[model samples]
Target chain A: MLLGKVKGKIISTRKHEKLVGYKLLIVEPYYGHKKDTFIAADKLGAGIGELVLVARDYAVKSGLDKDAPIDALVVGIVDREPEKK
Target chain B: MLLGKVKGKIISTRKHEKLVGYKLLIVEPYYGHKKDTFIAADKLGAGIGELVLVARDYAVKSGLDKDAPIDALVVGIVDREPEKK
Candidate 1:
């Protein structure tokens, strides 16, 4: 899992039916120099600017009854912020 | 998902009970300068030196009855090798 900051929410009008109730959050990695961001399914009610833990791939389908196309997921909200280098 | 080459198998004598019956394989990324390797749970009977797709995080626990401590999983074995750069 990687540490990330939720940047924003995604609104998709057309998506898989199994993804209907899943919240999509845009995340930026906290420790990397890479500036690109990715979207993650959020079930813990994470908010923008909050530090969260993101998991990737089919692990994204864990805890769901049906399979979805999600490649990333917001697994947890960090209880404390880490010091930056 | 990341493409990886299965380097070897891991033998864990003591692990989580939910992890029993899962095949553990060490993986090396296919397209990176990083030489470090990580272990992934494999269910599709992949073999050493085979190219496979790896999923990370809780997505690793997808399709399992109980949640395991695995952070990675081999979801597929590549049928063809990509052209080398």
Candidate 2:
């Protein structure tokens, strides 16, 4: 899992078929890492700027559709901010 | 799929049983991205410093064991360097 913040969300009306009812969230890892922003499937209602844990592998689609093109998923919402190094 | 270059190899004798016969390579994406080095299973015999296309999602384990703990796989080797903008 990767620690990241939900930067924003993408509202798509015509995405892949398998991703119909899911919210696509844009997330980026916190400080001390590259600012690579990626889109993940949000199920736990992660909101903008909220700290979240993203699973960016097969585990994301394990319970859903094994072949879903969705590569990332928000697994948790962290309650506290990360301590600055 | 993401484009990356093989930086080095991990020689481990006591890794997960599912990753026994595979070569674990350290790969980093090319310029214009965060230098996040990650390990991926190499089945194509990619060499160090070679540009490769890594599948960092479920597609990687589609053909093999879907439950395999391997998260990334070198899907293809690029023939030339990426064009800089």
DockQ of each: 0.06, 0.08
Q: Clashing pairs in model 1?
A: A58-B59, A59-B58, A59-B59, A59-B60, A60-B59
| lDDT, candidate 2, B1-85, per-residue tens | 4556788998998777878778899888653254577888877788998876565656565534435788777655665653432
Worst 10-residue lDDT window, candidate 2 chain B: B76-85
Top candidate by lDDT: 1
- In order, candidate lDDTs are 0.69, 0.68
> What interface RMSD do all candidates show, one decimal each?
9.4, 9.0
Model 1 misplaced regions, further than 4 Å: A1-85
lDDT score, residue B28, model 2? 83
- Per-residue lDDT of model 1, residues B1-85, tens digit only: 4557898998999888888999999898765434657888878788899877665664554534466787777655666654432
> How many angstroms is residue A3 displaced in model 1 relative to the true structure, after the best TM-score fit?
18
Model 1 chain B is weakest, by summed lDDT over 10 consecutive residues, at B57-66
* Top-TM-score candidate index: 1
DockQ of 2: 0.08
